[model samples]
Target: MPRPRGHPRSLRARPELQRLEPKVLLTTFTLTSPTRGALLPAGVSPVGGIVIDLIGEGGSRVVSQIRARDLFVGDFEGGNPPESRGNPGTIGERPGFSPAVVDALGGALAELSVRLTVDDGDTGPGDFDRDDNTLLLNGIAVGRFDRVPTVETDASGTAILSENPEGGFRNDRVDTGFFHVTDPEVLRLVLDSIRDTGAIVVQLLDDDPGDNFFDFTVGIDAALIDVDLPPEPQNRSPRITSLRVEEPVVEGRPSRVIVSASDPDADDAITFRFALEGDGRIEPSETPGEAWLTVPRDGTVRLSVRVEDDRGAFDEAGRAVVVRNAAPSVTVAADQDAIEGREAILAIGSFDDPGLEDGWSVAVDWGDGSAVETFPVDRPGPIPPRPHRYLQDGDYSVTVRVSDGADASEASALVRVRNAPPALQQVLAPRRVTLGTPVDLAAAVSDPGILDPLTVSIDWGAGEPSRIDLPPGSTAFESAFLYDRIGSFVITVTVSDDRQESAVLGVPVTVEAPEPVPPAQAADQALAEALLPADPADPRPATLAIAPDGPGRPAPAPSPSPATLAAPIATLVGQDAPDPAPRASSPPPIPVEAPSAVVSAEQTAPAAPPPPTESAGVAAGSAEAPDAAAVGPEAIASASPSPAVVDPGPDPDPDATMAPETATVAPAVGAADAAEAASSTAVAAGDDDPGAETRSGAMRATVLIVAALTVRRGGSRIRQSLRSASVRSARS
Candidate 1:
């Protein structure tokens, strides 16, 4: 399509294009796709894939060729190749974005700005810069797989858009999420053009580049249909529409102040600036109509906003915001279901009194016996939610509490934790199996729900699938399989529980025709097989079963106290302990007193978790330990600078009897202090390695052991062992 050098409007009207009467033709004008930017008129570039005066309503061109100047809209000089592959190359197929504004723009609303954000199945409804290897709405290069309503660029830097997207990602049409288009030039065309012609003629194109049509696909989805457009436009001084202040603005907390203004000019772009005229503060955006206001103390503050258009004309508006020292507010969005052993998410929104700079603290009771997590915050922002993984399948009520020194707020969310899929612990399948000779296949699987029934389905990749049902609570199974076909096949095994959740394992196998075994070799193999250990009557593997300690369930006693743990220590390290005769007179289990959580004076807390199941192994409660993951090195290092705590009571007997397995152990004094100090050193030294987190847990156990051993060695040895344990913990 060639056009003369001087004309901006390459579209000329054909009277026949007018299907409606001259009086009422404008419904709404919108562009659903973006176009390539080649062969556009001289001074025009579809910067955001927009063109003027080209309209397509109901999928047909409203105007014919603009041949009034002796040149018609024609096909590109070269387009399709000899091998078409049956895909018709469009005429004059050029990467020329010819999205025409609805002729309603001649008198419609004047200004708009189109902003886009990436939805990578994570944080979005925000803003983003065009990343390199732009996968602009999946138009050109084939990119990585992203969820629908997402914008992702491939790692190889190609945004893939093919004619046939089978078994791959294809989201050609989508909701132009939260559209707010405000390009003044486009509005002017639509608003005034309709006034001039009484009918809006338009075309919306998302198409190919010139001569390159043979390779590239047709278009990319970019909807301007979502843009808000008014029917009429008038030239008048823009007035402030609204100035709102979000209420309950707490001191040291940030609150939202929304401002709006309207311009009736055909092509005016308004720029707004804001100022806090009182004790409050605000970081004004150059062209922002809304801002966050923060004040140091509780009081009233005045906010003034000024709006100036492209012209020198301007208008001013003011609003009052009340800041108070109120309890922090919290709102957590109900997130998707959490898989067992995976982090459960809580989407917490922020509520600022005015946008204060003070810090706060939060506490979370996981409703599991694991431990309560506490985080001390130092900034006046939304406190981060602690991460916790449930160990079993059940409902758990997670509670979140926040304190800002003087005031506190709490919330809760009901979380349903589904069973974790069975794990493929071990598999035994030969790479090459003799055809028709009984080939043995064995797979070991374990489920977190020890009582749940399990099944294993095997697909030999020979179009046959075989399933084996294991005994209830069984964790392993072995079977003999016979392959009749002689070819390479993938032995795929899928292990699923009643929950429909499953785990799969695949191994390659080649079944070959059997070869005759030598008589001596066959006898030797038979003797060897006869000597091999017979398959166990029960195939279940011996492994430690994880017990779920739900809320309200008191912890079972073990060592009792560090003062009398010498005997129990031997049993813990694998030495057997003498079994005691059953006694109904056993003392009640000691209360499991957990650590304390400290809250700061300036924080806002997020939402809480769900309630707990009745038969939990460990009750979820606030058990705050300032680990390096939540808090940083400085915080961890200073967490517990106090010396190792030793009870001043008379020393207990060194040969004190150990408590029964059901007996509870009291927490050791200064153990948290030692663990925190050790963590800080590890973090500062950057000892990040594979399984560092897992090792940290073991280190804590070792700390408790050392603390137990020190009780019998007297006070002097206590300090020495504490230092030794702290030093050794860094490498853990």
Candidate 2:
């Protein structure tokens, strides 16, 4: 008989007698490497397209393929002849047999014989012992088999027997060869290993090439192998601590950005890259650990700082620092006591950043056409305020500019510069007064908003000096001066209030002279003569020196003697004296004389004859009367001479008698003396010796004396008469 294909055959002997019908059953088996089992009967195939279903009754199935080298029967521990594929004559002498296969089969039987005794089977003539036992070969019954046992068949008759006398046997065994390998621990281990390497395993499922079975293979091609790379340390968020900018950061200045992070895992050493956000530029820094960025001039910029670690972790921070092209502000103020045209101190206001490493400077423009002053402030300290003076009058604008290293600020002050002199308002007292008269000088000074105690000075124009004092309204400057000079004089008054001075004003003063006199020539002369004296004989002369005898004594009267009368009369004569010869002779008298008594030497004897014409002849009984008659009958006949010499003298013409008594002096004087002597003697021999009679006689003597003296005077005869009459009347 030919060995059945795809199945194992056993060699055994069987009895010739009945040919038992074959029974067939399909069973599933899981085949795997290191197979250990008895070969299947001839002409049978394992179930489900498997060469062998190596599975427990209710356990998981497993399958594996053996490598070509490990598939040889000699690799097994048991000595069993390899199964034949061609016709075979005996169980051991079949074609295509290997001796290792036969020995493996024998060894398997010997092991089984040790465990159990063999069983007899039917045999025929020419039958050979073959291992073809159909025992209940539970895989669990057999504890373990090193190698599968092969079976041998005889070709002469259909009988199977035990070839090596170790019959087929049953034993308790676990089918460990069919390893139910669902080890979750092993899968976990594999996955952990992959993870440690930073890799991931991908499983690929495919149909097995030799069967319709699903198989799994690890796809290392798709596996992600994570090498021991440092994890990208969690990206640290950056923080901006502060922002600073210079006075003015131009294009040349390198702006800075500082970055910080809170990542403990990050190394302090970092790589920095700076970018100015929003239209900004950056220049690579030449210095180590420095990031430089530039802000474009066209627009403002916000800077961003990016810091990266060696592990490719990065942090970003941003801040804004302004960049400007304009200067800053500086203010200026003046002290309260500042004065115009004098030194004034000013307070320059605060600056933004006065302290700078580079020196700072200040420039001032004091509004006037003056030179600008520049001061340097290199450090932080109190700057001593400076003094400034303005001369012109008006409001002024003061500007101050402070410069830092790169920026500056300016401030302006409307310094009201009042260089104008104050206005002078004058107050005056008694605006009008008399000329050449004294008056009180008063003046008041008024300046708007000025304090009291204003200095004042007055030019009174009266040769008085100026006075200075504080005025109470219109204060009076009392000074007495006579304005004798007559003209308009300007009284210049000037005032000053220290802070300002005023102009001088001139007030005009008028002076005039007193009034003039009237004319009355005659009356003036008469009054002058009356006030003076006429002659020395007249008690007082034209100019008198009347010496009072005592306290109450009256002035003495000069006696009326010839010399006394002649002296004053000579003065008048000298003033009005005619030819001397004409005045020397007696003047003719009037014929209206009373009859005169003849007082001859015999007058006592002659009460004798009352001779009228005869006595007249006696009175003129001389050649003088005849001569007076011979010269002119009228002169001789009207001759009225003195009783003593009228007849002897030249006859006074009647026309001469008509002349003033000042022309008839001799006749008048002789007659007046005779009369006076007669009265004196008569009074001496008064009848009763009466005082009244004495007084009458004295009065008559005075009258006669005055008449006689007056008749000898010149000028007018009427005037002499009136004067004599006035004297007589006054005495009476």
Candidate 3:
């Protein structure tokens, strides 16, 4: 039975008093986690019972008779099954404590006693019928509670949980409040004797000594009571035992902060609220006392936090730290109008930085196959212009990288490398030349890059340019002159490279006027043409004339000597032929284009020519034929091999004389055929463009060659005729 609750009127007799004012509690004795056999024949449910004894102030014991509350079966694993009934530590039973309330022998409630009980070893319903198995017997224990969440000794403390606890409609344990104590100091005294008793246990035995069953460990428990006691020591707020913010929190970088806090109340749950006094963020990590804090920019920041307990108590702590320097920010723009082969300069457009003294460097990649250029900057100010030289033309992406000691940023700008036009060097031709004189034209060209192939068109202030000899890997090209008319001429040279980059240059040259041609010379020129060649259908022979060897030598007059007229007398072996027909000539210059002037027939002369009767004339066809006293020079030149059919080979020595055999041509029908070929060539060329002296001069040369060939053949024929006549006479 529970006694009424009351506090003593006075402690004046406290020293002599054996116990405090009376108190009562609904006592509970439960058998839980009963393992072994429950002292039965096999592993089965046990009929449990409890015996409660309240020992008051002076160790005086009061035996309380309470039949086992749950006298039913339990499962094989030492727990009561849901359908069966047993004691698995469910509280709330008959109120039966403090019978003598306080023992008279002691001033305070001294001790309490509990014993577990189970039915006898008999199975089934007869188990608990025998009263002899009412109480826990000897020293051997049956089983134990494997795990316990927590245990406490506070005055109003509640047990977290013990093994084998249960709940019902009005559950005894409410959220970890399984066991409660009104006055822990009094309870401590009550349990003092058993606490040090070293693994105290409760067990029961059957008649068979060999099979010891129903052995269990009965635990000491706290009880709910009504008592008037001093207020519990106030719970203390959680403390920041060691608040540490890792140093060197760089801008935009994560830094670690650890908090060490504790609550004075052992059961208090601690939590932390982190905040920052700067432009930063605090994120709680998975770990309880750790967090990550990041500041966006460089500056001093304060990390403040509050450690709180479940109770309304808290402690605040804060720390100030300077964030490390951030990478300096700078805006970059580039010069788009960059010229090739010249320095392309980059200008720094704008800059924004937090650290004025941060050491920084800027690297520029010109992207023009050049090396990267880097410049060190002491601080945020006017950065020196970075420059690179691009030798080739192109569009480039200029990459600019700006880096402080710790961080770097990159920007790109598109820069176009304007193509550099070809450079025209000095023209190597003479400033002055005689009229009708073949001029050599040349000028140097450079493309401002590696030696690249070039296209060149050189105009000697005259006619169309048919060919230009610009060798591979050469910087300059040459063109021989063919000025139709002489004057103060301006030679134009156009140059270009594969990149379509072009340049033009003009060079002035004065052509001195020529002495006039006499009427006689004109007559000679006309005669040279008529005597030049015969149409293949009908052929004829013409007269020969010799030119003055030098200005001091008198000119030789033209005359139809027997040797000259004998050209028609020459005979062939197989049939009667007037003259060896001249080889066919190139198709008449088809006027493919109406150019300003005619193309000069490519020409070569190893040396000056000799008279027709000389051994040299008997051999090679030389272009320097005294053109019928200087009129056939053009004709003879035309008679020489056309450049179209010949590989002009290597240039020959101008001062070296070619052997007559060296220039020997095929069988000739006098110089007449050569002259005819030249004449036709000249007529066609002049029809296209008359007064083209370059063509006329070449025609004159070809004529002389024809006339010389005719004479040579005539002489051979004359000898053969004489030999035939003499042989006939001897045979007669």
Candidate 4:
């Protein structure tokens, strides 16, 4: 192991002797040969040991060296001098050392300071005493167990035994201490020896061997050295090049932040961390450098990411992410025409960005002072139908609102309600009726839906007014009025529903006067037929031209008076016989009232008949009385009718002369007698003829009054008075 002759100075100089870099060593040593009761035959002992030199060109070197020890004890029971132990033996053996020489060196020897640990199970002494063991490394005493402290148990609960009165049993008592090689001379001497020997030595021996024999063994589980390898480049803080949110940062929406960083030292591992300033959820993503976060509900959210290396150096980056809410948009529509009592449907539609689709609700206001209703919406689309009813008739504004917890939008529409009026179906009434008759008025009315009570009114035009109320389901109304006067009239009907809607209709009515009758027995019969009474059940009131103590004002009845019959008979004859067919000739002359004067001759009469003689009238009147010459002509006719009236005038005297006197006397007599007979007949008719007489008298008075109104056709001087003549007499 000596240096080679004339080698390079670097190579020749021993590492232990030169000013060199510090090195580390690890040695594992063990002793197992001394069985439980082995005796102290203290010549030499073989201990298996190895040296791990941790310094070489590649920074690692292992040299296994078997070791031996020699114990030359005088008394042998502990208390050996430190100089006598002289470091038991070299830790790693030289290639040529023998057993005695190995022990002679006192332990493994090397030219270096050392720090070491020893766990000893050597039960060298049987009991506690002044004698104890001493430990050495490189011939420098390091530690001692002088008091022989009580054995402590290991992790398995077994007693850590030392040299005791009984024996060493299952002990791993640890004694830790360090030794420094500070003396240059001693270090040189040891280095010279290592140049020759190539080993380091450590030892344990009895301090007072005469009293405590060295009969125990020890094992070392670990012996290590500390050295400074080139210090790794100081760990550099990780660099954060970029940091950002991966998706659009919509408020309340989930997204992620991505960070990019690097560690300067290749041996350093890195990790990422994230944080936010405002409301949000942040977590690590699948990727190491990315973090997941929920977007905050604010103007801007601060996001920060930190990259840390294994050496605890970290770098951080911050970002301000703009946070926005997706404002919802909605539209509202409703049925245009809504009835006051009917239900209406409102259609609402809405939409939003996908991110805000959840946690949203819809609200509707019916604008009629009703509560607003809210409905949760799971998806963005049309909202469910909203139904509402309006009690009042007017225009109402409807609104729909859509909100996504954070934002809202609204739309409005107009819902108008209409009021319908009542309808008038018809007005039933008679157009014409006689005075004093009652007119019935009726009407039919209706409204759109089931209506409230209806009010019906009629203006009967003649000052009679009537009103009636019909219940909800009824549509008919009736009224009655009597016409007091003879004239045209109008009736107006009005129908109204509870809502104050109304309609009106008009009807016309007319009333007329009755016809009059003339006075006579025959006329009385005619009047009876014409004025027959009406049926009782008739809705119409009885009518009469002449009112007498009735519901209406009474009017005067007409009086009966005589009417002539001669003119009517003469007119009948004139119509039945034509002038050419039959002519009464001069052979017969007709008497005015001969009971039935009949014409006998069929010969044509001459155009001019000679005037009558005065003596002709005397003879005609004297037939009934002698001395007729003494009576005036008027007296003679008043006395008695000529036989022509009592007895039929003979064949109207075919021999009768055309005497001017005859015509005068005969007509005068007949007139007087006819007047008397008419007067008598009128008296006989009595009460029956009173109404007819009244009517006839009214007619007569009307005609005379009409005649008086006429101006005379001739000169005023020729005017004559109209005498009060009997109606019969006037006609004759």
- Tell me the tens digit of each residue's lDDT in model 2 across 312-361: 43445566666544344454565233455466776655444512235668
The sequence of per-residue lDDT tens digits that candidate 4 reaches over residues 1-732 is: 122232111110001111112423221111111111011111111121322121111111112232212222233322243344332422222243234433333343322222222334344244343245554544545334442222322211122322232323113353222222234455455534543554445555554444433322133211212111211112344567778786567765677777778865567899998888977769897889987787645467788877777856566668788887866778666546677656777566555544434468888887878799888888777777767766556788878888888778898888887766677898889988877778987777776534457788888876758889888767777788987888888788888777788898889888887655533434422322232211122122111112111122332222222222111101101011112213321112222221111110111111122222223321111011122122121100111111221121222321222111111011122222322232322233234544434333322222211111111111121011111111111122
List the global CA lDDT of all models: 0.39, 0.33, 0.41, 0.41
Model 2: CA > 4 A from native: 1-192, 195-199, 203-255, 259-272, 279-284, 292-302, 306-454, 461-494, 499-512, 517-732
What are the TM-scores, per candidate, against the unseen true structure?
Answer: 0.22, 0.26, 0.33, 0.34
Candidate 4 residues lying further than 4 Å off, grouped into runs, are: 1-392, 395-414, 432-437, 449-457, 464-476, 496-501, 511-732
How high is the lDDT of residue 232 in model 3?
15
TM-score for candidate 4, please give it. Answer: 0.34
TM-score, structure 3 vs. true? 0.33
Question: lDDT for model 2, on a 0 to 1 scale?
Answer: 0.33
> Which one is best on TM-score?
4
RMSD vs true structure, all candidates: 53.4, 33.8, 23.4, 21.9
Q: Which ten residues in a row have the lowest lDDT in candidate 3?
A: 9-18
